[model samples]
Target: MAELFARDTLSSQRWRRRLVPNQSFTLGRSTQKYPVVWDKQISSQHAQLNWNGVQLEIRKIEEAANPIFFGSRPRISFMLDPGQHFVIGHTEFLLENSEPTMPLPHRSPRTEVTIRPEEIRRTSFRKTPGRIELLTELVSKMTASTDHDQLITIALQQLLHGIPHATDVQLLEQSLDGDTKTFSPIAWDSRDGVSTPGGSSQSLIENATTSHMCVLHVWPNEPDPATADFTQIAGHDWAMCIPLEIKLNQVAALYISGKRARLEGNLTEVEILQDDIKFAELVGSTFANLSRNMALERRQSQLNQFFTPGLLDHVSTDIESYLAPREAGLMVLFCDLRGFSAATEDNIDRLIPHLHQTSETLSIITSAILAQQGVIGDFHGDAVMGFWGWPVSASENPLGGIQAAWEIVQTLAGTEFLCSDTPAKAGIGIAAGQAVAGMIGSRDQVKVTAFGPPVNLASRIEGMTKPLGIPLLLDDHAVTQLQSHPSMPPNTFLRLGSFRLSGLRQETQIFTVNSGEIAWLPEFSQALILFEEGDWPQAISILQSLPTQFGPRNLLLQYMQGFQNQCPASWSGTIERNTK
Candidate 1:
């Protein structure tokens, strides 16, 4: 014979097996499917020739371990295209060859017999490269999904369809000693080759038990599990055994006979045994590096979630390292979502996207605030509450707050909601002062919100429109801070004469924003007077009554949602302004 193919020596590890007094070989077979085998006999050194048809690779005939009646040595298997039998070599073994026995109450869900290859969808792997390697790759993708089970079932189905006489497949696994061990793992590969969903899992944790690892029989019987591995699995029939194992975080296993094989190949199976070693230890170590990098990404995301890019710029150390609670003269700005309540009914289909779009709007403002080194507080539902400076900038630029607010108002005013029938609008409120800044709110409500008079004033201005009927408002303190700022849009704001704020004894000189210093002015007082007089229907009608309007129209569109839609038909021209 040609010298056996010399192959690379695999890892040579010390492995010893304890001899048992009951040292006997079992022959197993099943009537439902093919017989699987332990292939530790696999010689990386030599390639085996395909034999027993396309179903098996032929090994040496003497090594087949054929069954004998006398019973002098270990054991042998038999071909049971009919009864897939397993013959055991033990003292006082059965004297006669018997038919494979069926399990009691055999109407079990897992016992459905699957015989045809087409019964399940399995294509013979004809691709170049390793057959086992292909099996490994496909098997690697399986999870607890039913698709995984279907894959294996399809393979068995195809095998049965081609060799209609074949039945009784067996199962095997690697033992703690890293040796092959076969057993009567349960399965039905005949009627619905898709019977027992053998291996698949959603969690890597569950993979511990369901991974396919190895098989037992090396040769095929006349298309039957019974005679397939009679020597390996005896006295059982009509079932399949699967051995599961995980290697390198990937899993693989084997399948075999079930409750049908009688004398020889009844339940004989192929096995792959690995010692009780921590496979995950090697796996975890490999994943540890990946875990660290993933951890960094998670940390980065967490930080980005809280800080605006502009705010992130000055924050030099890790996010956990510092906190600043005071600012010299930072401006405080609040951007309120106007006409927000009606969105619940008006744009029911747009709830999520609206929220997201709203967040993006707030994000744009936050981004601008961050650009100018401003800090952001928590968003209270429909309103964004935050102060500029501190934590991000130690000293506040009251002008920075005004500029940020002005830019915010301008951005939203000019920008239309892509989803809106009309452009979306918001209210901008600006206030500036020396204020405290530290974490506020009780433990239960602990939020990175701000404190101090400027914050309250900004928040109050955000809602001032309901009373003063303005899209944008600035407290006198804010105006003073921005009086010299270079970026302030040149706009002639209509001054609303001083009025005593509720808490303060003195009047706070406030102003309603009219137009950008560079743009055409609007009739701010008239609109304010109508809205304040509770003539909202006419208030919206008057604005809806404009031609090629100014930037502030966005707020009116929102405010109009709050007013009744019983206005006169003359407004339809502008209403089509949005519908168009």
Candidate 2:
């Protein structure tokens, strides 16, 4: 074997190449074909060198404008001898014969040095050039990868390049469940681009558990009972398997096969050349860590999906902090499907589909609420409660809730009903005030919820929607906040008369938005203003003149007509609710 030491002047970098007998290698700027391509003033196919066993021949392939020099003289072809110099552009090379020669004797008595067997082994291992570089390149590739399967594939490719005799490489991952054990191939590579021992080689995998490292001297040609199936499957003369200890009682094996017999010291030579065992261990540990991290990330994502985004961030940072109770100003929203019960009554065939549609509608509603930074609190039979300002505060909770409610109403309006004759519809109520929010319930079954007047008022208002024939309603506090909010326009809401809610003493002012394009809103608002100002006759006249669609369903109109025959002496327009 002969060696060429190429040195660069500008970068002060050096590269070494071994010249094999009767074989040619190129040096040029094309890295795909040339082994020693560099950023120099050289042609893509600059030169080629062929070693004919004893002597070395160099031929210039490209006619360079600048002369190619051999010992400071321009030459197109020359036979390189030991210690000969050649130059191509700014790069220089020196030829050196690596033939073994006898050691020269010293004139004086030199101290006899003894090398231990381990030291000799270590020295031999280090002398194998590119071993460290190969390991570094493999590690770089592994670290840069995020996917576990891709990492294993990269490892197989690197192994094929690092181990010269390795004709095929396969990684087998072992999985254990109770008394059952299974091995599956994760990645593999072969010189002929066809995987050996493929997926059908289960018997070979079963045998891998018997030993940490297994070597087959005569693989396919002389098959033994222990490895006959594998030998036939792989069709190789020699093979080795190294087990990587990933965890306790769990291992993944790296298998390498070749169609060549092992000469004396061949196994040790292979070990010294590439350190295959260490590489296998690295592959196992890297993959194990990556798998663990991926599982953790998946679990985190699953947990995050269960909470509102604002609450999820807090939950991820600290569970206790997120669960801790705190007083906050909030806007609570309650929404319930109107005809869900009737849609699924006494109909088991339609029950599942109805439930699916309900779930989908709930998902759409929750998405709208969450989009406005609201946290979903609880779910009843056909209702869902959501609130803003718990884990984090919104700039304007009332406006946010109203916007979310509007979006919900719009979404349901366009949604096709799955189990109903009519399009699906829902009633939503929003109330804004101070509330206590936190995780509540037993240790085994905890729930994040809000408590106080705002939450209760929102629920009551939602119940009122069924009788009032309104899709969305808001309380006095929410309307006031929305009016004062910087982002909300003043005319967003139409004020309804004040009413005493069921089970509540104070009269709560109610309001509703023009969810659809209702042409009677201006007249309705004038009637409400007249009713509030004690002009019952004028209010009754405006109410009677309005469309009948706005009469029976309108709570205020119903109250006014009930008192039309005999008006109260001091009516304050406060309609009291008898039931929730």
* Top TM-score model: 2
**TM-score of every prediction relative to native:** 0.38, 0.48
Q: List, residue by residue over 113-146, the lDDT tens digit for candidate 2.
A: 2222233334434234665787777768666655
**Which TM-score value belongs to model 1?**
0.38
Q: Give the TM-score of candidate 2.
A: 0.48
Worst 10 residues of 1 by lDDT: 271-280
Candidate 2 worst ten-residue window by lDDT? 101-110
